[model samples]
Target: MLKQFGCTKFATGEDFDTGELFVQFEHRGRMVSLIASSKGYAAAWLKENPYNNRRKGTKADHEAKALEKGGTAVYSILRDWVKGQVTAIEIGMLSFESAFLSHILLPSGKRVIEHVEEQKLLEGK
Candidate 1:
């Protein structure tokens, strides 16, 4: 049964030190909670790589190196999350990203996403 559901905006922007996004619900007479994006999840990532000099000095030198690091970071985070048995996730600013990443770490992609908003803003009101 559903008990609680909602996503809160970061109090101090992306400074994970402030807070995080998550959801809660009741399952089998117990409340299951999930916490996500509790830290600067994307700050260190998407940046330059300290290793792999060859990834640079190419056509997209700068961009390629950065993207490679991003991919590796994503893999690491996903793997860690799986090991920790976290029940929720937030990534790449999209629902599919969460589902796809979770699938890689969770069986059957056995994940469920519920998005809720008080007032969704749309173009032209």
Candidate 2:
């Protein structure tokens, strides 16, 4: 997966470790690490930092209401996939702007993520 995104050498440039999914490579002499995570993980994070039910009197409040929802958990998951520069297996109808946000340099891909922890091994279980 890392190689798919031009991340040939490990960030640490050492042998792989199972406990962590971080991979790094130099991009113009700067090190960038791609943190791979599962949809479940992002969903758990969303569940942890829930929006406080405050007065809906501000624009931030309205934005939170729309962005911070149970359904957006899937968005958070896909965002991480984009962050990691994962390959695009399928892209049904997602918009290009939505797929590659300004924060992520890699384009987004179609993934069916359902767990906080990946059940498949790096070699693909």
Candidate 3:
């Protein structure tokens, strides 16, 4: 979807130990990076669909399965989201910047969301 929208560069990385993954792409001369953690998704999944002690071997086993499911789900969801957003951008319903503002990477290697979060925290002080 990104490539179809003039994204020329693409990269992906994962932390096997942490189940953290990131996808980066260059669009309209700006780099956008999005990160997701299988573990984090698993946690949320567990909350929505809690463990079934009667069907599982152990809690750990159930958690492992959830992590796998969440990992797959995250990619599928991300793909659909990117496709929809890109379509919206193409149709003039949304701008790329507004669609991916939080995922945009700055020269400092931090995401725009991180700066926005920091500013919000400072404002609360």
Which is the leading candidate under TM-score? Answer: 3
Q: Which lDDT values do the candidates have, in the order given?
A: 0.37, 0.40, 0.85
TM-scores, all candidates, are 0.30, 0.22, 0.83
* lDDT (10s digit) by residue, model 1, range 5-119: 2323212112224434444333333333344552334335433333355554654565545555444554455446443433343333344234333222123222322221123
89 Cα displacement, candidate 1 (Å):
15
- Candidate 2 per-residue lDDT over residues 10-111, each given as its tens digit: 443212232123334543333444344333343565466544566445646644454445234443444466554433422435543343333223323212
Ranking by TM-score: 3, 1, 2
The alpha-carbon lDDT assigned to residue 76 of candidate 1 equals: 57
Clashes of 3: 0
In model 2, which regions exceed 4 Å deviation?
Answer: 11-21, 34-125
| Quality of model 2 by C-alpha lDDT | 0.40
Alpha-carbon deviation at 122 in model 3, angstroms: 8.5
